[model samples]
Target: MSTLNRISTPLTELTGVEHPIVQTGMGWVAGPRLVTATAEAGALGILASATMSLRELEDAITEVKSRTDKPFGVNLRADAADAEQRVNLLTKYEVKVASFALAPKPELISRLKEHGAVVIPSIGSVRHAEKVAAWGADAVLIQGGEGGGHTGAIPTSLLLPTVAAAVDIPVIAAGGFFDGRGLAAALAYGAVGIGMGTRFLLTSDSAVPEEIKRRYLEFGLDGTVVTAKADGMPHRLLRTEFVQGLEGAGKLAQLLPTLRRTVQFKNMAGQSWLELARDGLAMKRSSGRSWNQMMLAANTPMLLKAGLVDGDTEAGMLASGQVVGVIDELPSCRELVDRIVDEAVVQLKAAAATVRSA
Candidate 1:
């Protein structure tokens, strides 16, 4: 439907999309406008439901439906206190695909599959991929350490093939990918497709402020860094002065602001202290993080809101992948997807010509 060449793969087949590309659901950045644009472009555009309340998420889904009949997905936090309610929202709207930020429970996968919704969870390890495949997920999306936000240390080049080989389901690779060349490389690595977060966030369809977008464009490859100071876990972010400040500060100095943001995130997320505690307990059990780490984890939403929503770089933390260095312009989602697919077809054909059967 998107007026462009088609590059089909198992990803397109599994998700019923025209292109083997995914617009990742970056919190605050992946809203209705961006998702609608992506769907219109014939790629799977995932709405970031992790940063929304149940009401907001419903409204977003409704908005996208009104804009386009094309298929789109919603990204959910499997560890959320109301994950079941979120999953129910998808069924209520008849959402075509449901993606998770973590490995979802077996029953959740069963419920989604029973409703005929495709289940794809993001994993960082072969073990995670095998576990989810055994749970009957339709597919798996695995991001390497080169990805932004909370991430692992494994680079995608090595992780992609390993996971692709271990799972019977299709593998969609993420991290350090931005163009058709990356897509071609991913397909060669046995991936069915590629997912991109930073590249999509830099697009014209994204709601991120113009000032923030300009700042992102100025970053070189070394302009990004992975630091655990923000939430007591490895997080990839733009190397901004604010992040540097956090890195330089002692734990005692960081605690006060961390606690403050935690409360702010709680309020903005519409969760009471009791609900936060319940969610925190679940995170502890799953992640094995200390109470301090759990408390710091609450800082992510508000800090991201300050930078991404309120446009306050001085007080905000910006999540980004190393690919930010090579990206220099903002194109609409349709333009981006079309160019990638067209170029991928060329690259794939060119690669085929270079090899011969023995």
Candidate 2:
């Protein structure tokens, strides 16, 4: 069967999106340009709204609409104080999908659904997937330990199958997926699609500095480390000296500097100190993390904003997936998506032939 034949569902059909692949909504990463490029390339590209101000977020949605008429998704923080406002912007834009960085309330889901948005949340565990599926999430993206940013311990190989078995909704596998073989593997494991983060970040279309992208290319698969110090939650990142230094320093030892950096980040991100602290506290409470962890958690998003938006390497954190090591060249979004789809088709066919021969 053709690779396209392997995935024919409401997701691909209703969205009018061609490929099953998705460019995940990465904070300070996936923006209007990247999202539009992905949608134009036939895959669903999700706008990362967690790092945006409410004004910036709306402008981004407008920018994406200006670029592509194709279907696209907007990634929002479910717990943000302005989440309702974000949802209102999504409805105004008539965005095809709304993906959540944090699990949202059922009422929020209902509100978005009523406005004709398909909801998908990134889940790290089966229980979370089941809960969201029951709550009316159209689908779930399962990112494994190999993913970037805040991630879970289960690898995609294990987690994808588990979540698929536990939930009735479609599962999009993520983490450690960088090539066609991985896409074929995900399909074999019953995932309807694959979501990519670092792979997309390494692409030429990404607005990140060339130096930063090169840094990602230099690593091997083992070069990335999952450190809890970036945020209160364990986050996958490139093993930079900054992260190593923070690791050795006790949480209390890092508090003052973290606070100082938080202020700087607030200014850089166009947020007030009060807003930043409030967001930090909200994040901590939602994650069930402690005060120290919550305070430290500010580092990741702030650093990411600095790196991507301000091009300040010293103050920025590069939250990259393990797949970063394997990506050597930066291809355009169109080239990357087409190559992945074509290669996945070829690979799946070859695997089928081997099974038939066997």
Candidate 3:
């Protein structure tokens, strides 16, 4: 038997995973193969289902089951018109966790817990965290401004400890986390664990295309730009020519391409015009974004798909964090998790020794 010291936290106990490191549900990046690899490596790997159809989500869940019995999660959009149907699929597959970008309805939370699925919502503010915790969220993953994809303005160093102190439920700190030192810092902030997106995306086990991953490696901390133009939300993306054009273009200039990608996304997702409108309306109501912004939302899936899945850097936008600068190698999930845990243990021990000497 191996004798590596394993670290446990409220996150591990809640998710039933061996480590508190989580491969966040990054669209296009988190899929079955990557989830399986992360799961086998003893971390919680969340399947990104926001880009999937209901059928695709079920199929992906089944595929993951065939590959490993270890615990994993599915990320869902609470505002999606078919949210209830997707929740039913979670119980149908006996999924271990249901993670959401928005605070799911209280009823959904109760039902998910009833079915034994841990409900963790990604929140950006203390108020949102408190709301979800009051709604019975098992845990909350809070992403700060430095995070990849859609993010808020505050960095994790400021937001994490504030949210952790406000909520009774376990808080998972995300944004700017990649190594054991990040995990140790999160623990020091009273967080249950650290959730990583760019870190996990750069892993060899990630399904992201090799060239795309290499492109990500080429960026430094200054490489990422948070532009609301991509999706009408403050989204942190790589400083690519495509994104730069987006920044420089007028609404009229971007309209045609945005509409084109919308149609492409509708066909790929198999969403009817009516379904698309309803999702957009729901998003508009929740986010208070304009109709133009609602239409702009279609660019996210296709652009990310083109970049992460198809490797067309010019046509695609790269979602990334500042952590991409410090990351140079693509380690496998097992190596990543083992080293993170090992290093965290050493860091924690050294701190304890410092206290005794003081």
Model 1, residue pairs in steric clash: none
**Candidates in descending TM-score order:** 3, 1, 2
| Tens-digit per-residue lDDT, 36-129, candidate 2 | 8888888899999887888898899999999989999999888786788899999988988999987889998999899899999888888889
Comparing 1 and 3 by lDDT, which wins?
A: 3
**TM-score of each prediction:** 0.98, 0.94, 0.98
> lDDT per residue, candidate 1, 36-98, as tens digits?
999998889999998999999999999999999999999999988899999999999999999
**Cα misplacement distance, residue 352 of candidate 1 (Å):** 1.4
Q: Give the TM-score of candidate 1.
A: 0.98
Q: Summarize candidate 3's per-residue lDDT along 166-271 as a digit string, tens digits.
A: 9899999999999898899899999999999999899899888898898888898899999999988999999999999999999999899999999999999998
- Which is superior by TM-score, 2 or 3? 3
Among all windows of 10 consecutive residues in model 3, the one with the lowest summed lDDT is 1-10
C-alpha lDDT score of every prediction, in listed order: 0.92, 0.84, 0.93
User: Between the candidate structures 1 and 2, which one is better when assessed by lDDT?
Assistant: 1
Candidate number with greatest lDDT: 3
Q: List the residue pairs that clash in candidate 3.
A: none
